[model samples]
Target chain A: MKEIALHMLDIAENSLDAGATKVELLLELTTGGMLEFSILDNGKGMDDETLKMTSDPFFTSRTTRRVGMGIPLLRQHAELAGGGLKTRSEKGKGTELKAVFVAGHPDIQPLGDIEGCWMMLAAMHNDVNIELRCSTPKGDFEISSELARQELEVEHLNESALRTELKRLIRNNLAAIGFTDGKIDKTILNS
Target chain B: MEKIRSLADLKKIRDENNKGVELRKKGEDADKLVQVKVAMATCGIASGAKETMEFLADSLEKRGVEAVVTQTGCMGYCYAEPTIEVTLPGRDPIVFGNVNVKKADEIIEKYIKGGELVDGIIPVNYETIDSKE
Candidate 1:
């Protein structure tokens, strides 16, 4: 993927396909020049064998195709960025995928359209209670679909205008936390 | 760039938008509206499917087309990335391949609004998980 946000999104889709009703994504950027996300989903998880083979690009749980590259690509990206991916799951339980990356590394991908990422997740899957929790060294912020729905008094979250509003909302919150695109401004965090 | 840390701020923005709540409420009768599904798998995103999805939603909303545009997994058409499925009311879903922003708009205008078929359709020959019955 060209961006970390896309990778998160791709992985989150797997969670949705696994019958996840609630997905929580936590993105944290620390002063140590590390960025990571913990995507936790309440869905049908995998057995030990399936989880082990997830790093192999050819292994997939879906019968749609013979190849599954989402997890493998994430692992490749994480390793290239001087970090790695860790997944823990159990059959009939849920799954938690944590990927860490050296944000300042040259191979590290840009965080493309973080707001757009959240917007797509919320708008596309209205039945799913998706939440984005962003934590920086300075402070923390969260964007929740349920709360936004209640505040807006709108039933569906897929409104195009509402997506525009959501993008602006996410962008402003990230800016307030000293994050521009994906990288956080260390100077601002210090102040 | 105003800080939008609270949900009330979001409501303010929504209320300020030109056609916000009423139009959203109009979509409550989902079965009566046009349905759009964008394929957003790994290959699709790499081929700019996200942009197509966003554009379709925006264009549909601007044209005031009562459509529910949602994202779906790969339609097993990775060779033709960025595919989409359009389902008019009480109609079977037709899959279109290689859908960039331009193609998505054309689909919206021609197939969706005008009820005309385009050239990028990949005939749905494969069976789905739910089709095994």
Candidate 2:
């Protein structure tokens, strides 16, 4: 994925496929130029053997194809961006993945279109509850499917007007939190 | 993680749980149910296909419409990203382009519900594999 948000999307998909009922994603950008992205899911987690081999691109539990590239690709991106990937999983419990990167690193990819990510994921997996929280120098922005559903009085996140409202809410909140330029600092790379 | 070796076994389990909700059935004709295919390729995602798909799913269910919504790869219509192909029972599938939430609502209300075609129909330039034979 060319964008960090796309990577987050792929990881979220994996969580959903695992029968996750709730998933929480946290994106934090510190003033020191460190970007931390984490996803925690309550789903059927991997066994010790599978968890150990998750970083391998060639290993996959799916019978459809031979390779599962989500985690491996994320690991590659993190390493290229002067960071690392960490994962913890326990059988029948859940999984948590965290990737850290330097915002000013030349190899760090752009965040890309995150509004699309939230809209798509929330819309598609209405059965799964998602809580997205991001922290930056400005403040913290948080959104959750459960809350959105309750506020809108809608049974599902895929409702047309509700999705629109959610999109608007996320965009406004992100803009308020210094993401108006699409990144923490546009001059970070130039510096 | 345990490997899913037998797709048939998985289907059996799913079928056991999704008695009436299952949209597609073995040996069933396409005319038996409303079928919707949303483009979900990279371009489509970038162009808000995800939002369009969500609207279709939510509205259909809320209105008590029985439809099987699925995703498909690019249909060589990058210019018309976020496109959808809706096939009402016993009718040829119609492809609509540039579908947003509003367009999706119109589709659900005017076209899918009332059987009246609306705007944004991308003329069918090619035939699908299923339509060929």
Candidate 3:
């Protein structure tokens, strides 16, 4: 939860737990220093009550433990960093989570280990497909697991060599888009 | 972003792929390979489990160890975040706690490769469904 990217990973995991077959993650940094992070999932959408209750740290439908802190913590982080979070869902449809933060806010956390996040998502969920798109003023990049699998001729994304190739592609592309060295300000927003 | 046609080509970009997405499928037989399960729940991640898992996968691959690395939910040990269970073929699984990158490397070298138990072994206080009893 220290990094906004960690929040992104946590929110995406929630989608996977909800039985989502397809998940889309979008990260955009605007010229005005606003970083928008969004995840769209085709899982079993929450009902009105569940949607309302998700903002509360103590309210979790999971029986494994009593508390679920992903959503609440993300909300807290976003708000504290001079931004906010919004969620929309409908029963039997899907859910979308969007959070925005100020890129240069002193309290804003670093974008922790996004490559690790994407790799975990791809490797852990072979059946589920994920599409990640990151955009900045410098450039934009998109990676789709389905496309990578097709091109690499691998049955699963977790194949050692293929996974390595996919990770390389993502990192190279992100670097091209100026997301290098984990510093988003000088590379993307300020530049 | 070139196409990988051979193993050498794959090796050329291995470090760039440090995420190590070598996830194992459920119900797959672990009889012939070392089985590693990384705890990736909220607590585990907050404590840097992702980096440890990545290191395990990369180091094992580099050392030519045949292993299946996968992620699992909480093992009810939040106090010991970033835990891992290593099960050699035909042996009882050993749970290691607080496994950072260094500890993971040591586990791979001393215990996994040398067959000598290392530090960080967590005693089993509760029985799981697959426990041998």
Candidate 4:
């Protein structure tokens, strides 16, 4: 939870565990002086009971354990930065989680290793259709795992060479959008 | 590697490169092949589970083994930050704890390949609500 990117990976994993075939990770680099992001999936959504306890660190749906801190931790991360988190889910529908972080807040965590997060998400799950969309004042750049697979003609995106290539591609594209090195550049605010 | 500004650019380089690696045949439950579920809760991530996961996925593919590597929530093994459950075709799942990249490699070579049980097996004797009769 130290890095916001790790939080993204955690939530994406939750979507996969929920049997989500389509996972979308959206990032708005700087909005109203805040960093906003969301992970949406068409997986098995939570019921009212489960949704109510989502922010409770001890309330977990997993039978193997009793504690689940993913959501709680993300909420805390957002709050620490003078932002907040929102969750909306319906039974048998899907889950949508949005988190915000104040851009200038001193306690804001760095957006660590987003490239690794995206790379792992795309590489690890070849069957799942994952997409990454980063929106900044400059413009929006999107990376669809399906599109990438189609372009590369690679069945499984787990190829090490391709992983490196995709990671580089993500880094470069994100950089072009003024989000680089796990933190947004100052130019983004002016633009 | 040239600059990959877009997917098109990426495709241009590997234009002729197509083939190699098979996840599973069409219409077959890929889980019937090899299923790896990695614990990826906060504790797991703090303990470098991400690295282990990437290693497992990469090595499994590189070895030509058709496996589906997925991430699961906490398995109540906070002490063992990085834990993984491996299920072979038609076999019960086995949970391994304190798994680093090296242990992951060993598990891949001996357990997954040789069908021999590896060390660090965390005995699973409890039942989940889904399993309760």
Candidate 5:
């Protein structure tokens, strides 16, 4: 699980470097007892040969770097957790990354603070469109940038204040939806 | 154990608990709630969404914002990572990206609390035909 999220961080970084303008994130916990994580992006997707080679530990597209282990790490973690990772991409359309974790697996960690995940994205990529959604047995939750910009009254909403407020909102929403058993102690991050 | 049959039963249990003291009853309308969305899309994570998300959740809890933080699949743009969206009651949701730990702190300090826009502003370029303007 640790490596799964870490792989997520890595692939997403690749997309960012590709000059993507929007990214979509989805986590679906199906009634069939499957936990799935998929990231889709409009950045320059990989070619067919590269896609096939990404899983190989020794294969990497980086010309300057000798070793690229992100994809291999993802494969290792997913398989260790009794899950698997799949990637599909086109040169222009985009790429899709999916990983599935079996329910009740001891290795699969609970999806951590996802709301905070988006906040982190906002802090890093301030100029891109981002949409995130999660669906579970309980219900569904969604967040979008275009939606927030339209609801405000200020002529120009302050980005810094918006970030803080978004964090607060995500925490509350997660609690409301039972994303976590209880509120995460806020003191940990700031201190 | 017998299943909980109604809202009243849930409330009764809440009333009996010490952990949730003075807590508002569930099943009530979420009229005044705040909703925060984290873009865990590939682009977002590559830009350090993981650390940023952790920071925000920890920070928000410290602030007692009564909010929810979660990871989302993606929104299509790959350049701006670690993206996030904020939604307050009766308001539109806001999205931001290109985040790091320091940016997360600034976000918590300025955007979340003060309702302000910060440095990272992703320019939306993709468009669909006959859209709502």
Candidate 6:
């Protein structure tokens, strides 16, 4: 919630909740000079009604709180940065959410350390198949848990120091996006 | 700044950074790390996954377990919001539903370091259908 990575993370969490086994999470510098981030999931997509209602801060199907606000927050962030967010979904097919942040826009927030994103993700959804890709004007990087397992000869990437490796992968992606100085706060990592 | 075109480059840099920490090189067993998965999906949050994850992270630090607490997508058992799964060394992972700080404490005390399973267990069914199939 405090960073763009947190919002991307929240959306990814939602995608996973939609029964997605394979989620393609992408962040790229689009040709339009905007930083575009998208999460495509093979989950149970929402109906048109829900998609239309998602932007409304008060419309949530969940019986939790009277105010539903994640989507609204994402939309506000995008608009404030001179870009926009869009979501498309089909009932039984899947869902795709794209959020664009204007390139060099003064209002655009910096992309936070992705290692935190990846660590939280690895430690969070060990069961789901998550593929995260990020590209920038300088370089690009990708992490596929399925592929990592096949290459590393391991079952999962969540435990032990393997998580550290995942953290490194995330750090590299952030560096590619010009977030070189960002390191996993050792206190958070050890915690 | 060289280009990072593949996973290999990523790994090289990753290993280089590992120099600062005592990385247990790839083939060694990771038996002591306590792995806790926090369900942070919309349903999970509606049920308080954020608070649960924070509590676990904070409490684990206090206990010196060196655990990694993270948020995850939903496990489809909406009835069981705020679900958590704990994986200890050499043991089958256990899933607990309706998890809160109290349950988290029990998990840290009984399951994480104590090796005892508490209530609210949600048996995992890996055979569930994926629409792609």
Docking outcome class, model 3? incorrect
Per-residue lDDT of B7-84 in model 1, one digit per residue for the tens? Answer: 668768767764635544545688889988898988788788889988998899899788888788877788888999
Report clash pairs, candidate 1. none
Predicted candidate 5: interface RMSD?
Answer: 13.3
**Which 10 consecutive residues of model 6 chain A have the lowest summed lDDT?**
A182-191
> Is candidate 3 or 5 superior in TM-score?
3
Q: Give the candidate order by descending lDDT.
A: 1, 4, 3, 2, 6, 5
Provide interface RMSD per model, one decimal: 4.2, 15.9, 7.3, 5.2, 13.3, 7.8
Candidate 1 vs candidate 3: the TM-score winner is 1
Model 6 shows how many backbone clashes?
0
Interface RMSD for candidate number 3? 7.3
Span of 10 residues, lowest total lDDT, candidate 4 chain B: B18-27
CA lDDT of every candidate: 0.82, 0.74, 0.77, 0.82, 0.61, 0.69
lDDT of 6 by residue, A1-191 (tens): 55576677677767777889888878786545677879899899999998999899888655434555678888898999899999999988999999988856777766664555655555456567778787655556777766665555545554445565667666755665555654222222122
| Tens digit of per-residue lDDT, candidate 4, span A51-137 | 889899988767766678888989998999999999999878899999998877889888877888988888767788898888877
Q: Looking at candidate 4, what is the lDDT of residue B51?
A: 87
lDDT of 2 at B114: 95
Using DockQ as the measure, the top candidate is: 1
- Please report, as a residue range, the 10-residue window in candidate 4 chain A with the lowest summed lDDT: A153-162
Model 4 superposed RMSD (Cα) = 4.3
lDDT of model 4 at position A40: 94
DockQ of every candidate structure? 0.42, 0.06, 0.20, 0.28, 0.04, 0.14
Arrange candidates by DockQ, highest first: which order? 1, 4, 3, 6, 2, 5
Candidate 4 similarity to native, TM-score: 0.79
Native-referenced Cα lDDT, model 4: 0.82
| Of candidates 6 and 1, the better by DockQ | 1
